[model samples]
Target: MKHAQTFEIFLIAPPGLEQSLWKEARAKGFPSARYTTGGVTLKGGWEDVWRANLVMRGATRVLVRIGEFRAFHLAQLDKRCRKFDWAKYLRPDVPVRVEAVTNKKSKIYHAGAAKERVERAIAETLSAEISDEAPVTVKLRIDDNLCVFSLDTSGEALHKRGHKAAVGKAPMRETLAALFLGACGYDGQEPVLDPMCGSGTFVLEAAEIAAGMTPGRARSFAFEQLATFDGDAYAMVRATLPAPQRTSLSFHGSDRNAGAIENATANAERAGLSDNCHFRHASISDLQRPEGDPGLVIINPPYGARIGNKKQLFALYATLGTVLSERFSGWRVGIVTTDGQLARSTKLSFLPESAPIDHGGLRVKLFQTDPLP
Candidate 1:
């Protein structure tokens, strides 16, 4: 049997993704959980941590919930902080950081004071101190009215795939890009195109998927820092990350901006996907299908706020719709945009097929049209 220890795990995501995660957790066989804005809480262990990191399409961060204690006053807070088993997971040599969030009704009005108590507690109990005034080891987060302590198990944001050293402006994050692709039912078997391929995120992600790649394989997770973490198990995990088979699929992307095309090409090469994905400079007014393979057309066009011009933004979206409706008649389409109204200007009739999604603070939405005409 697998060793299972109950931890109060918190799965952090964008604001609206909580419900989706809740549904995902149930479908994926996680136990019942409590949820709030930006996250969900449940019981899990290191294996659960690994599974969540590797498999969860929606989760941005998986926080291993250490402990949570409540106190209305400063003295009470300090006394309670010292009682945690910080020693179990922390070491004296490893440095740490402290954070705190206080509610309106509490006497602990000063977040600084709460952080001090936790820092003192860690030093006294674990014989280790927090100095991430340029932190080295532990990280902390305090939510509204509550301090739910966790060690940062994902170091850099999960989206920093270390692949896209060159990026397009207003770039969508890798993890978010992956989740949205999954939401669109991209199985890596069909040809994929990005008409507004800013930075080539969709094309690159599609190429990686087609090549049977795991998004987390190329990066180091913060969990590797845990005192109880096992390296041998992780190596085994990494070794199994690649799929057994690869396929021949065309991932195509186009942008009117010459600079963006160059950046996309460089990023694709950096991601080891240059051979699988094709990047070109073309306006949405002229995007066309490749010779073969019926597939999905995914786009992330510039909204008014992103590009700062409303008329041009609507025109771009409108052109994107025109190309989709006329040229790519048999292809499926998925358009990601923050502006529902701007997307409305696309006038694709398939506009009703949209699904709302969230990315960090942004309320993102996907308008999907299909090949089933």
Candidate 2:
């Protein structure tokens, strides 16, 4: 395994949050990080790939560009793939899956045929088994007659974080939650409060960040099955992470549903954040300021698109706005929703809306406000 060889690493960011993911990558020591259309790209070795999977909170998945070639057609692609150095990245014993996407500009416009060629090449040349259920996946993107091969180093989406067994009807993904927190200028020092917390994604993620906990600590990554993986070296990488920090600031979450409160509490316990995270069953009308300095008050309340009727939600939003404005003075606010009209109903002063983000097939934006006067 050539651990020292550098390659282009891509961190798939949530739609419209590429800049946030890029900032996080750079801050986490990937100085070469640059934002692209769908994700952030940087140059690093195998260990850096492992580290990105381990610590990056905003990335949905990490991919490594193993190699590339020019293929005018399926036959040419098959020939090049057979001759490529599969041994460098894949082991013969492990099953592999190949997926391909091609644009019309490419001569090899049939993605299915391209995928078959690559999978056959690996199975025949490297003597590896090909299975749809394989844990290791090779992603090939063909554009302008150039086929680029990338390995999905993170098998499961980074949002899974391997915790939180329970989820509500419309749960905010941890990746998006982390990015939203960043967009609100959260630095893990001040506390975070989610009035409409669902499964406690925002509160738990904030708690983990404040504690200096690695997001991937409890999860296994696809990179471990690659040929370049070295358990001892990876162990060293994990060992070098900053020791967990203890903070007095607490993360709080509340929900109108009792089951959501229970789920949030259990999730906090599973994430080892119970001590600093507090969850209770309370409606938006019942929300109160915690006994401490004002921090961030972020929530993903029910929008008409996913949960209930739009007309009825106005009163809910209005009541929420009234509660925050009347009680939680000096606290910043971030609201995630698909409807701008619903957001405006809050009657709170909001900054300009963020870029439209894709949430569960709906386009949503983050509405933010500076600390309340």
Q: What is the lDDT of residue 128 in candidate 1?
A: 76
TM-score of each: 0.87, 0.99
Candidate lDDT values, in order: 0.72, 0.93
**Segments in model 1 whose C-alpha atoms lie over 4 Å from true places:** 1-4, 19-37, 40-42, 55-57, 105-107, 133-147, 242-244, 351-362
Alpha-carbon deviation at 333 in model 1, angstroms:
1.6
lDDT of 2 by residue, 133-191 (tens): 99999999999999999999999899999988999888999999999999999989899
Superposed model 2: Cα runs more than 4 Å off: 1-3
All predictions: root-mean-square deviation over Cα?
A: 3.1, 0.9
Q: Distance from true position, residue 144, model 1, in Å?
A: 9.2
